[model samples]
Target: MQVTNQPIDAIHEEVFADTTSGIGPELNLINPQPESCRQISAESPVLSNIELAKLKNIPDFEAATIPMLYKVADGGAGLKQALDAIFAAADKYIAEGKCILILSDRGITKDMAAVPALLAGAGMHHHLIKNGTRLRASIIIESAEPREVHHMALLLGYGVSGINPYLAFESLEHMCADGMLDISFEKAAENYISACTHGIAKILSKMGISTVQSYRGAQIFEAIGISSAVIEEYFTGTPSRLEGIGLDEIAKEVAMRHEPAFAEQNIDPFSYESGSHYQWRNGGEQHMLNPETIVKLQQACKTGDYKLFKAFSKQLRGSAFANQNLRSMLTFTP
Candidate 1:
């Protein structure tokens, strides 16, 4: 409701509030060791533990995946330790029929992405039948085709999850940098909604209560740490964001229609790039995209003539823009 009194985080807490019966602490999924799940305080712009934990609980809805963000003091040892901790928690979830998706953060390499995928595939039965199909792992690499990443998700049988708004926004920024308009108006509006939804989801996930509709609505660029004035201004064009409306109101707007718009396909990237580690909002892990196939995303990002940068960003793989050349190209000022 009254978002003025509510800070962005507070509103998110309200929107994404976890109604799922005390899942985190009860599950004890985080590491017991001080190193594992060790709380770190970040300065402005960086998300907090409370906020990161909010997302930690999000994979429960359908087959969801998220990248793991860990801080390591040692050179590569930290990576191994973090993976160990992740697998430990992953082992439990897989044993229990719950599928856990892992995307490694910066410092994680293509090799790392492969390791977890191999482990999860092999242990799918033993760790699952004995426990449940709880853990699954992936590494995000560079690809132009958004579907390349989507297809991988399908192969894993996780259905498609929209980390779309995040990608769309990145794409928008990428377009802006290039001073070229490749996105369409319809796509822009869609991205606006998604960006708003993602922003709200991060806030709710921080508070531990994000839902499908809420997450989708929170991705609006205005919702993610931007000023309220800006958020309201952007939503002016949307039918959903009426004059007196707030996020909770917006959440209600898209809550009922829950299925993904397009059918999942077996799209994989032909020309892919690898990175040591790439990152995204909500601490997403390194992702794979096909720069060569990115043309497929033209339709997805190009919504009519509007070129909704925000929506198009969502269609991109989380790591598609992490490349210096790509990021520079996207953000390049004409």
Candidate 2:
């Protein structure tokens, strides 16, 4: 029930955490609807170099500038290498009087896979915390991965001071140019940020949290499918009861994205995969409430047939697909 637009707190090293419930239909970040997320949006001042590239026009974003930036040597070096490089850069940056460290996947190439931004951010955070030097400087992310509220919340929770959501901004620009969005690009980007902040507030309010300072690094939820080893290492101190996946799963997921990004095949770059998270897509991710189930329900309603209804219900609830939730993992015992 508590709420505040401006969050005030002295966030030491304990401001980053991985408390999200990982049992979504896919392995995307899911802020529980019940708990209210704090901050709404990060209000802290962050210095960054991204202004030289993208994000040069947003009002009130260019508060400061970064003197030094760190990055992985190559994107095709695999996930482990990328992480190692990031951690190494962390130590060097901290030692060199650098106040803001930028972890970016922008240098990744097509030969190898991409490291999930969540992993990079969370890994660097814990690494710094373990070394007892996390509070030395802030972390900023310059990537194309984060676009939605949940994505931004995860970044904030994992200890990033600010995010240069260049991809999201570019998408808005494209939408404006293509007439998909009625407003100007700047207005669309501002609205997107507003939407993310409000969405995060809704999640924090569900958990009864009042501010981003309290919510940052709080690790508010439990992991449903991720493994304990992964949580201990990256999400450290967060709960993973099911012990589901490890680095292998994460690597595979990253490859799924990396493979298509640089493929030399003849396909439209704009024709991206229509992931069926909300509405269903052809040859895409399967959803419980898909068109097939909807038609069956309609047919059963029209005929008043119990058997038809049962079939529809069974298919809707007990079907198998890549998108798995906690609901399908449960069973009744005698």
Report the CA-based lDDT of candidate 1 relative to the real structure: 0.34
Model 2 alpha-carbon drift over 4 Å, by segment: 1-77, 299-303, 316-334
Q: After superposition, how far is residue 159 of candidate 1 from its true place, in Å?
A: 7.0
lDDT of 1 by residue, 280-313 (tens): 3233343444442345456546655335444455
User: TM-score of the candidate numbered 2?
Assistant: 0.73
lDDT per residue for candidate 2 within 72-168, as digits (tens), equals 2233234566577778877886777554566665555656444677778888879888998875655667777887778777877777666667677
What lDDT score goes with residue 94 in model 1? 42
Computed on alpha carbons, the lDDT of every model, listed in order, comes to: 0.34, 0.61
Scanning candidate 2 in windows of ten residues, the lowest lDDT window is 19-28
> What is the TM-score of each predicted model, taking all chains together?
0.25, 0.73
Compare the candidates by lDDT and give the number of the best one: 2
Query: Which regions of candidate 1 deviate over 4 angstroms?
Result: 1-85, 92-102, 106-126, 133-172, 182-334
